[model samples]
Target: MSSNAAKLIPVFAALALGTSAQTAVAADWYTGAEREIPRDDWIVAIDAAATVTSNSSAFGAVTATIAPVNTLLDSGPRVRLQGVAGTYTYPGTVTGQTVRGVQQEGSVLFGYEWIWQQAAVAGYVGFNVRNNELSILDPGNPVVGTGIGGKVAADIYLNPTPDQFYAVNASYSTQFNAYYVRARAGFAVFNGVFIGPEATLLGDDFFNSWRVGGHLTGFALGPMKFSVGAGYAYDRVRKGGYYTSIESRMAF
Candidate 1:
């Protein structure tokens, strides 16, 4: 790997170690608690987000996960069915022209989750199929074609206190050598509402990007949660731009 890529290893390692420590502490605390364990046999979660950047690029993504054995609130081995799709627009080879690309991925992963009163973590590994489409030839585009490959993913949620919350999500796919990681932390300002900072890093064989911003998260209405974020984004191709995103998640 290039020196630039090697520099990221430490960041990833620190995050992983922090997650493991938090999980261990939460588990130990729950083991001695008298509260009854919560249980739900099935869960379906959906998340969608859209981002527009100043670099004349707009992107959108949506994902759904179905856990048949246990819900996200509880711990157990589960069969996870996931689907992800993303679309984006970028500058084309010809000046003043634009190109669009779409990516779709499907995975059937075997996963195990551990839940505690204040924290939860889950890990998954599976086979995935990815498809990519480009409206026109754009050598600047990172994702090129379709392939079948292996994928690994992890999710972590932490609520160390009644008024604080943190979440982390990371995933990597062998297809096109793609990877994404995001982390956010918030403090409750009102009932069921949190406001905080967020960061993201994502890349592929030919593209890399990072974002730093703030978010309003955990806005709950009925069974759905909503979040909105705005930040400064920098990418190898686009240099720098501002971005805004809105996300929604539902579990039932």
Candidate 2:
């Protein structure tokens, strides 16, 4: 299993499950990208999900995040932090065997935003730490290890008309020997409601894969918004399968 994917499991799980928002302040539904903190606003969010792969592997995960709306040290950049935990189950890592394990992760990020009457744009960079348990099926498995990585992301939101919305979010991150890329876009059906397509490409020296999907986002209540989607996934090492996701976003 890719350790990096474990840290990101919450994102895909939410996309398929369609429950609870991820990220903190500047929430991005796909890949859990976060916008720059909105003016004078703080946000909190929790995300949970479960997934079963074509390999007969099942996974469950949860993530909690928090951020202050204010800039860092009264500067131009916004800061956010996150914590995550999850478990993985593989029915046949070896012949007639089942494997299960748990993982925990933390991340910190900084963002900058630029706004215009017609559009808003933001970018972020951050570091992450992850601890994972090697599969129980392995003898003398490395039970736990600390791994570190960094990510960069950019997002844009556009309002062509008072009631029209269009947006895109994209990011790339690298950890240890693995890297990840995600991009998603949406066009409003009305006011704050939108539907869009998304793509994810991830891999390392040992593994590589891709997922293509489409999602629907709906009207906001207070500061929260939601989305649901389905997709096909192909892994270089594990082959291919179908999957789905759901997500919500809120800022207060």
Report the lDDT of model 2 for residue 134.
54
lDDT of 1 by residue, 94-113 (tens): 56367777878787777776
Tens digit of per-residue lDDT, candidate 2, span 57-93? 4444444434355421122344545565656544443
Whole-model alpha-carbon lDDT for candidate 1? 0.66
RMSD of 1: 10.2
Query: Which structure among the candidates has the greatest TM-score?
Result: 1
TM-score of 1: 0.75
C-alpha positional error of residue 125 in candidate 1 after TM-score superposition, expressed in Å: 0.6
